[model samples]
Target chain A: MTAETAVPPTAAYAADAVLTEVVGLLVEVVGDEILIATEIDRDSSFNEDLAVESIEFVALAEKLEARYGARVDFMAFLSEMEMDEILTMTVGTLVDYIAAQPAGEPGGEV
Target chain B: MADVQANGLRFHVQHLRGGRASTDRPTVVLLHGLVLDNLSSLYYTLAPPIARAGFDVLLYDQRGHGMSDGAPTGYDVDTAVDDLAAVLKACGVTGPVHLLGNSYGGLIALHAAYLHPESVASLILVEGQCLDPAHSGLRPAAGGYPGGWVEDVANTLNLIAIGLECNPLGGDLGSRGARKAARMRAGADTLLNQTTLIEDISTVRLLTPGELAQVKCPTLALYGGASDLVDSGPMLAGQLPDCTLEIFPGAAHALLRDAPKELLASVLRWLETHSPAAPQFTGSAGGYRLPASGGEGAP
Candidate 1:
């Protein structure tokens, strides 16, 4: 596990900062296999680029929830789209979602 | 993602807290089938809907399958029951739980309930294999239980072993399929056949009529209408007093893969009726709410 996997989300939100943390979590999920840390950029797609399997994606979702708590309503975020959309989502897309959220509204009621 | 140490082995456990996590709701524990299968089967299918219906869901890769540690021995029903007990305790689940087992997992669930009735609140067996001579026609004419499903299971194991040895290495499957199939085959070739999994399971004791009667928890048993295992469903239903048997029309043994929507519909209804804890529904604030019976979240 990387240091980012253990760090709690900060009160502040920056797109780049969220990207860095997301990439780190991806690294932890990908482990030493196929995941090339340097290749994961904002446009990197989970399926096309990382080839993340279903179970691995589930693990990534769990890791994201554990690190960010209620701030990231990962399931709710994916609920609006189809599985294909979720699989094709880019790292930048997730960063934007995280950056767009209000600071203290971690309940994610919206 | 949880790594629980139970039965002297490290198990990959996935516990999904529902909307009512803080409430004293009954947890639903799912058990997957033997080799080449894992918690992913249930995780992708029934778990989310059940969670949405307001119950915490717990799924784990059984020992030697998926991410769980593999042992060479202890594949018998007794060991499986002991493992379930230990895993529940390790996961801090002390209250009575509803067990949903698929394939061989159903056998383990029935045995576990019989052995430790206090731990299990109810059972949902899907295409459960009845290995005893009394259930199937494979028993010896001399009035002794012999080889039956064990041989079939062994055949499947051998096929998996061959697939493991030849297919992936020989470049037959797709890149991702090859990787996952290779991993599954590794366990099949190593622990599944090389160990005593077949012998232990073949000789494992089946529940007698009296013992089945003692497991009085509300039970739901499903089987495919056209499946060869259809007879086992009624046999099990006759044994358990409070059991409800539902056979899906024109479905086969691979009911999970086939007719998932219908299966989920039946499961949701069964849970709503039998779950000891009532569902705690919180308004989704205009979000999606699953109909009392349907397969909206299926993939």
Candidate 2:
């Protein structure tokens, strides 16, 4: 899902580019009015801090799959997290989770 | 704060003593979703019927949650649990009480009950599953993620946004009748911005079967048929030592709003069966067999 960026990404994003991308996606869906950072911190919560609407969150997630060439298990993520808990994630965290996954196919049964 | 103490912190609180049972008998303490204040979550729908039900009910914000006071440190399960315990105590509730937990609240219910089994009589877990280390449903790639890291991040964010909007999120605060609406939004933003909480939450996905074996109480595990939220419930039911599971066909994770009537009735029946002393309700139990959307399953 890599696209040619007008400007090359520096090592700065390398730390948690995925997280930045997610924050970027959130910016698009909720608009600039909603202030959201890339790396979710311990204190962040959706209802209390992000003001993200559930419907909007769901739509954005579906759209995310199209860019990455994968189908993420939407429900799986939902069942486990709270809005605040969601804010603390980092791009590095996802990279680690995906990097270790078995090759071939996406959205495993579990 | 309203001087309500749960665990150890003081919280803003409200009470509707054993209100109307939308589903019927037995007092249920309606828990709010993640980061939402008591007024934001309950003022919209739950409080009315619960008051009329004649069963005792209590609603309060958690520390660092909603109007509840935020500690200098941050939010965590242990703090939330303490707040819950304190609130129950303030309400003068000592014996076992029915639980109506939603989203993260569901996690708290299970944890609190396990920690203090004598406090929780039965559980009405709505779209929430246990987080047992052994049964953790989603296997963290041992050491990695499944696909493009950037894409995964975007997907997670987008999905989260959609789920939130569909929920009972109140409207803009600009309107006079909707001042609280603004507070609700502000609260949401606070909830979403916590990066640490997200990382911490990721660590909990599935509950081990052994942990489920410990929940011996009669539980009515409710899930939305249309929602992926069931991923958590499957393992939760499988692990729970005693559980009566039912899927509200067609509804999403926010069944309370998506199919309020159906869910309300089903919950009542579940209580009646589990506890014979359950009270009578204005709504009928059979009305919830199908979806409120009127088709195959639950709305």
Candidate 3:
């Protein structure tokens, strides 16, 4: 199912824009008060740089799903990575994955 | 984060199909433990490794856990079995599937196989408890929870409650941690004490040794050598017609988290032996049956 959003389906999200939104979600997950002055970059890793716990990552995945809809298969991307890869996964990697998907929600299926 | 309507409830499910081709290859379904645990347990620990090994993986949070809708009740084994069937149906998985259940999830796998034999190809139980506590001698006193479990549950809930206020996560994680902890604490209270889960589990029907022996599917049972429930592994392995038991020395009930590498190694070896993709079906009297060229990989 397509997640209804103001942005048109034809509009492609840039990698930098996606990273910014990802960091926004991270800030929400990390609590706005704590990450008030924190700056996130493409090189920022979820576990190492952001200290994202497993549960927090689950929340982050949910947020990504809500934002990107079916265009990105976060679960599939995660399932392909090793434990160490997950610990070291960066914002740029996820941004690239999102940007690399078909412009539409062609990634709805496994 | 995929939401599918199953058994009249919204279930948060994760379905990851790998590069494995052919429908005959069984999809690996992973089930996690009770309250406070979700699909993330196996997602982080086993799902990726199994998927990388050329197997499709399905993992989900039980009702009332994780992002799934939390109804006030329906936490019994029977409901769990039905949920499994519904989940498989929702995913459009028509072929038989392999199941890996950790802790209480093992009971679900066992009962699902016992009740609906055609749907399940095989089972791998990780630190699983037997259905018949009587057989394993792990039953609790009448109307009371298991001796140590009650205290453990209480302590866990208390810790969650206390941890929320202490900001143990410190820095930026504290707020999110507290929020998650509080939510978990609330769920633990409702599921453990207020719900029928305890009584349902306590009174769950036990399959006799004769019945267990009749379950002809391949089975692999693992338990931590230092775990209190280590003996149950042998009990299960002894009863199942085709079963293999593995014990991780110096490990405990938290074997999945404690020694994940060893657990993954054992699981991969078991999967290699079973090789769900290797075609096991020969002459079937049912529809949708595909014959394996030979019994090379047939169990």
Best by the lDDT measure: 1
Sorted by lDDT (best first), the order is: 1, 3, 2
Per-residue lDDT for A23 in model 2? Answer: 62
**Residue-level lDDT tens digits of model 1 in B1-299:** 56899989998888877775324556788989886678877776777778878778889888777678888888887888788878877887777778999988998998888777766778899998754655543343552324456566767666666665564454444554455455545657776557777667656677767778888888899999877677667767877889999999999988887778899899889877776443446767655543322211110
- Among incorrect, acceptable, medium and high, the docking class of model 2 is incorrect
* Residues B1-299, model 2: lDDT tens digits: 13475555667665555423322344567777664434435433554454444455566665566556664433455555666766766765555667778877777677666666666678888877454423234333343333322233335644664555565456655442244365555555445553344443444333345656777888888899876555555556766878778888889978776777677677666655654453334377543332111111100
Question: For model 2, what is the alpha-carbon lDDT of residue B31?
Answer: 74
Off by over 4 Å in 1: A1-20, A36-51, A76-110, B131-147, B162-168, B172-177, B277-299
The alpha-carbon deviation from the true structure for residue B92 of candidate 3, after best TM-score superposition, in angstroms, is: 0.5
User: Counting only residues 3 or more apart in sequence or on different chains, how many pairs clash (N, Cα, C under 3 Å) in candidate 3?
Assistant: 0
> What Cα-based lDDT does every candidate model obtain?
0.73, 0.55, 0.73
**Per-model DockQ against the true two-chain complex:** 0.15, 0.01, 0.22
Q: What is the interface RMSD of each candidate, in Å?
A: 3.4, 12.2, 4.2
Model 3 score (lDDT): 0.73
TM-score of each: 0.77, 0.54, 0.72
Error of 2 at B174 (Å): 8.4
For candidate 2, lDDT tens digit of each residue in A1-21?
566576554433442554556
**Candidate 2 at residue B4, lDDT?**
71
| lDDT per residue as tens, model 1, A14-96 | 77787877877877876756553337778978776666655566677778778676577765675555556777888888888
